[model samples]
Target: MSRVSRRRFLEDSLIAAAIAATWAPSRAESEGSLGRKVGPNERINIAVLGVHGRGLDHVKSFAKMKDVAVVAIVDPDSNCFEKAVKAVEELGKPTPKTVQDLRRILDDKDIDAVSIATPNHWHALAAIWAMQAGKDVYVEKPVSHNVLEGRRMVEAARKYKRICQTGTQIRSAVGSREAIKFIHEGGIGTVYLARGLCYKRRDSIGKLPDGPVPQGVDYDIWLGPAPKRPFNPNRFHYNWHWNWDYGNGDIGNQGIHQMDVARWALKKNKLPNSVISLGGRFGYEDDGQTPNTQLAFMDYGDAQLIFEVRGLPTPDLLGVKIGNIIYGSEGYVAFTSYSTAVVFDSKGQKVKEFDGGGDHYRNFIDAMRSRKESDLTADIEEGHLSSALCHIANISYRLGSPQPFNPRTKAFGDDKEAYETIGRFEKHLAENGINLNEATYRLGPKLVLDPEKESFVGSAEANALLTREYRKPFVVPDKV
Candidate 1:
């Protein structure tokens, strides 16, 4: 076998070992079509991956669905598995078989669908593999870790004829849908720019000592396609959301939701003409591998879209409201991240608004039963597009330069926000009893992007970082 194939076998071997005890029979009792009544109480057998942070909510949502039966839960983390198992039991239902590897669940022919909530890096591979295994997929947001992966995922769904839903649950909100419809119907009157804001403060993932893998945790499985790195707690848990190896920072983590709405409202699917962005890890000396503040601009023929992400995780950026705002020639509309949608004409007069209905998961279950792709308000492609915006922004930022620093003077080189970003970090450090009167802030230089390619037009290193070096055996196949 080639080196690549050999590595893949080893990874799969470890995965199989992690879940050998819990893999079980397929329990799908649903019929051919979701609309057809296969049985009086037929349930759709589903398997869940990444049962850690967002995975808990996915399990609960599946449990609540009348037609969805979660037969298996998979996570490399023993703690997450134990907690999810308990949650399943408390639902007064049969205990969901827990596994540490996803292949174990995918191997079972009884599972009708798989809901994947793994880290950003694992999202594309798991979803693509699930589809290849003849399973419908409901994957979390930013469908793929990179633009190419997102495209491949879209191709896989089409090639397999699978019902792949992206986890931009906010798209299912009644208010968000209606708001998009209103914008499309000329309510916003030719919106040229849609601004998406994700501003909140986040503390550091303290410097953790790298050491042996935690007990009961399959470190190899957790690493998946990501580059091999020492097991650092900061880069393993929820904090991984800020790292580049396994996560996509706040942009892909939370900003994609807003990007999805912006693109949907504009009805654009192809890549933008150009993109330029700038930002950096502003505050706190954390192990985060992403920017603390970022700005990306995308040009689409007649109009443009802007994406802004702030990692201050506190003190709201847009007056306690973080969402999409459509700026049109005649009017504007503010759609809440989760709640309602409010619109006002050019005169700043309230014209129409939608008080959204909660429950994006419920909507997916309803769509699954309907067997109609449209039933899913936010499809995987939508998520990919939105998430792509974030990736593009970060790419542009990374291509830039690290702000110059004067070690002797302990001062940033006269950059406006450069100092401000440092000040924010110092304030937090002071509160936490750390003296950082002298710390360097490396800010990437401003860089331009060709949105068409979703990469840096001038920088090779920046472009290289856009896609990851997939570990052996965990490769995402290229089918198209």
Candidate 2:
């Protein structure tokens, strides 16, 4: 037998054996067009992809749901299987079958949905495949690695008529909902600017030499869609967030939650008119490719969206270390956490507070049964827009040139907020022990965008970053 066919045969045999041992065929079969509709009372079988880091939370959350069954745990690393399987069993639930490859379970008729918690790169492909195979999907935040990939995900969801939910859990928070409602209702009168802060400190991954792939890991599968290269320890597991090929850095990481909220407050259902980014990987030098300290300014005509990512130790901005601050004519709203926010008048007086949480997973399952995209608090389109913001900002930064630190710049051009923001950015770096005179920072060019097409205008270099060159067989298709 051919090598590829032999591998597939073994994988198939393993899946059949595991399913035979753990899963029963007596469950109600999925019905309706493309298996889009699920019976309200029937259990919805799901597979949890990428069981390391955030994915473990997915397993725990879904296993606790009586209406959902985590029938399979798929990851390229066999090392994660034990903990995931135990998570289900400890909840008095049946043990979920384990697989190293997600494709092995995509054709399984009994599996009705997939909860994708894989790295940012694997998200689009895994989700598209599942939807094509007639499965609903709950994909995590910054849903795509780049602009084109995110748009394709939206297309696949629309064409397949699948219930694809984005894992921006804050959208399901009652506190956030009320806060946004208040802002839209003029509680924050004439909202003009929104700042998303990712002041969360990230330590250096430290320089590590490339080494042999770990045992029990399907390295080729793990690299899916990303270019093939030597297996470096720093680029494996959670640390992949620091690499450009596999991750979109911290902005697309923790900052995306706040990014979504900021955009939602502005009521923008499209991309911004222009975007520029500045910053660099400051402090200790490491193998990390993306910036550790960065700032992005996005022009949205009457209003603007500014994002800050700081990996070094720093004080919180306006009582927000890793959240959002919405500025307006009357007052401002501060999102303190994923499930909480506080409102303050223009005079700095506390006016109100909002605190509550809801089940994002439950929302996804509810939409699965209803088969309504509108039912999703964070639909695929919402994910695409927010994730595209991160990607565009990065594109500008990637195409930037290094310049000496200076408070004054024509980049803002008479905008006080943009000027003040850059001034603060300089001061923040100086305070962190960076010598402004000796150190240079990347100052990205202002790249204008045709929001309708979601493409950069005139600049071929900037436009090229909207998508990536996919590796063979693992490609996110042009058509989707």
lDDT of 1 at 8: 70
Model 2 C-alpha lDDT per residue in residues 239-294, reported as the tens digit of each score: 99999999999999998998999999998999999999998999889999899998
Steric clashes per prediction = 13, 0
Worst 10 residues of 1 by lDDT: 29-38
lDDT, candidate 2, equals 0.90
Model 1 off-target regions past 4 Å? 1-41, 313-320, 403-463
Pairs of colliding residues, candidate 2: none
Provide the lowest-lDDT 10-residue window in model 2. 23-32
lDDT, candidates in the order shown: 0.74, 0.90
